[model samples]
Target: MGNFLIVSAGQSLREALSVAENNGVDPKAVLDMLTTAPTLFPSPIYQGHGKRIVEDTQAAPFRQRKIPLKDVSLFTKTAQQVELSTPIAHLLSDLLRSDEARA
Candidate 1:
């Protein structure tokens, strides 16, 4: 399985601010990254914590012809939860480059 960090948006933002202060990086940059993450990463809404509905049944009340299934959206947790890859996390640390390193 691929390594992933499941974190709430609030927690991630708080951590980003803390990391920026601790590592001398710009917090605004981190916030910008967070804002653009969805477009860049295109993560699917994980529905592990959402409600489930079983459509298949052994018996039905009436006999009907099989019909094409329509698009059904499942319940998912709030937008607060996010799943980030480890490589992206490493890239965040790379933002803490010194002037000499940038040279």
Candidate 2:
């Protein structure tokens, strides 16, 4: 499993591919290495008073999909934060750079 961190408000698949190209990573390879993982953060507020205690059991998972670069709404409402490992970042950088090279 490769790690990639994408920092953006929201971008389409094509935009993401462009980013990957700018980062010098292969778009196809990135799609192939894609994985879907969801993470849920529990609410800090307590539901009940002193007599009763209620805990919120909500978990949100991160959804990863292998999509075409032309799809612009892929990154919409995906995640608020992302963290990618070095190798993954490198790959992405390569992709983005390649795109720039073509342009």
| Candidate that would win on TM-score | 1
Q: Would you list the C-alpha lDDT of every candidate in the order shown? A: 0.30, 0.30
> How well does model 2 score by local distance difference test?
0.30
RMSD of each: 21.5, 18.1
Worst 10-residue stretch by lDDT in candidate 2? 45-54
List the candidates' TM-scores in order.
0.28, 0.24
Model 1 stretches astray by more than 4 angstroms: 1-7, 37-103
